[model samples]
Target: MSIARNVPFETTLQVRDTCLCLHTQRAARALARRFDEALRPVGLTSGQFSLLNALNRPEPPSIGAVAQLLAMDRTTLTAALKPLEREGLVAVAADPGDRRSRLLRLTGRGQEVLASAVPIWRDLHAAIEAGLPASGPDNLRGALAALSQPALR
Candidate 1:
């Protein structure tokens, strides 16, 4: 008998058996979609927002370092940056310390766009926090940190 023929509809659709890495992934995805929609006015995908935010921290970070911080491969990260570069939100420049290295920097326009998106981000964050409690966002952040500590080592 075909497995599909015998299984109940609910059984067929259940994600519970797949060993989901993060139960919050669904929530995260939903949150990202909402953020993406809200950020549409600023012309940023959630992924781009994350990249911009990371690049905001320091200057002259090599492409490899940026990739490492984002937990992505150099090629994929480079691919993602293409649109950002094309839009003039970010720039890649030669690293003075290493001729072969390239540094990723956020542009002034990127900061402006990021600033515009901050209130929307804050709204989304507050919505998430409202669902929890006094310590919601902090506790969730802590949990993510604990979960990520091993991979970071």
Candidate 2:
């Protein structure tokens, strides 16, 4: 039998330094942790804050639409909604235009919670931006938005 060749350690180091997915995931997790701590007093996680913020529009969006915006699958979104629903922070109802399609909305309690969380988010976000290079925050956001495009998937 032919012997298998071993990959060089340098190649592993190169991937560790250069892989976009790895870097982004690490940053995402760190950011999530920071926000989670900041939001603890309000009893919300970063993901929950984001989900609630997305529903802060005048018109409620369909589940599919919210899933697309959040870059999550229907099942995952549905699972995430359970706790919020149980807390009476959100309501999922049949869309008036499409009976089979469900719409998601923030309840008054959700609005109250979100309002309470806003200043905390704002301060944390400002601190994060301040810690970045002068142009880093905008550049990083643009790069992330580009990567998050549906076409990229």
Candidate 3:
């Protein structure tokens, strides 16, 4: 197969508009894909990693709180948590203050799993950072923040 070089990225159909946004999304997709492949041995997708990290925070954060933190809808977050719960990696408890809500927390085994995944995560994060230097993350966050403002409004 012949390989073409200098191909422009596009997020939408129109060449001009898509060019502005497509590159970042393409980057995210590619990065996530690479992380997923690397994380396969640890049995954690990037989503699962975020979920476990959220749960591993202070015990018994409300489901709503976790969803908000992840910026995921409650239903989506609830559905995702099911697998972790079934796998004995997470435990959802009834909120003591509010019966209508549930609280999510990681189990001991979950902690162990997260600990196991850390090295792999560190390696991936390091590799990415190394490409853009130490401030790479800060720059990314800034760009994302700037991009999100209009959407939020």
- Give the top-scoring candidate (lDDT): 2
TM-score comparison, 1 vs 2, better candidate: 2
Model 3 Cα displacement at 25 (Å)?
2.9
* Tens-place lDDT digits, model 3, residues 87-114: 8999988888888889888899899989
Candidate 1 per-residue C-alpha lDDT over 37-100 given as tens digits, one digit per residue, 9 for 90 to 100: 9889888888888898888875558889888888788999999999999988889988888889
TM-scores of the models, in the given order?
0.80, 0.94, 0.81
Clashes of each: 0, 0, 0
Candidate 3 Cα lDDT to native? 0.84
Query: Which residue pairs in candidate 3 have backbone atoms (N, alpha carbon, C) closer than 3 angstroms, thus clashing?
Result: none
Clashing pairs in 2: none
The true-versus-predicted C-alpha distance at residue 23 of model 3, in Å, is 3.3
After the best TM-score superposition of candidate 1, give how far the Cα of residue 116 lies from its true spot, in angstroms: 1.3
RMSD of 3: 7.2
| Candidate scoring better on lDDT of 2 and 3 | 2
Model 2 regions more than 4 Å off? 1-5
Q: By how many angstroms RMSD does model 1 differ from the true structure?
A: 3.8
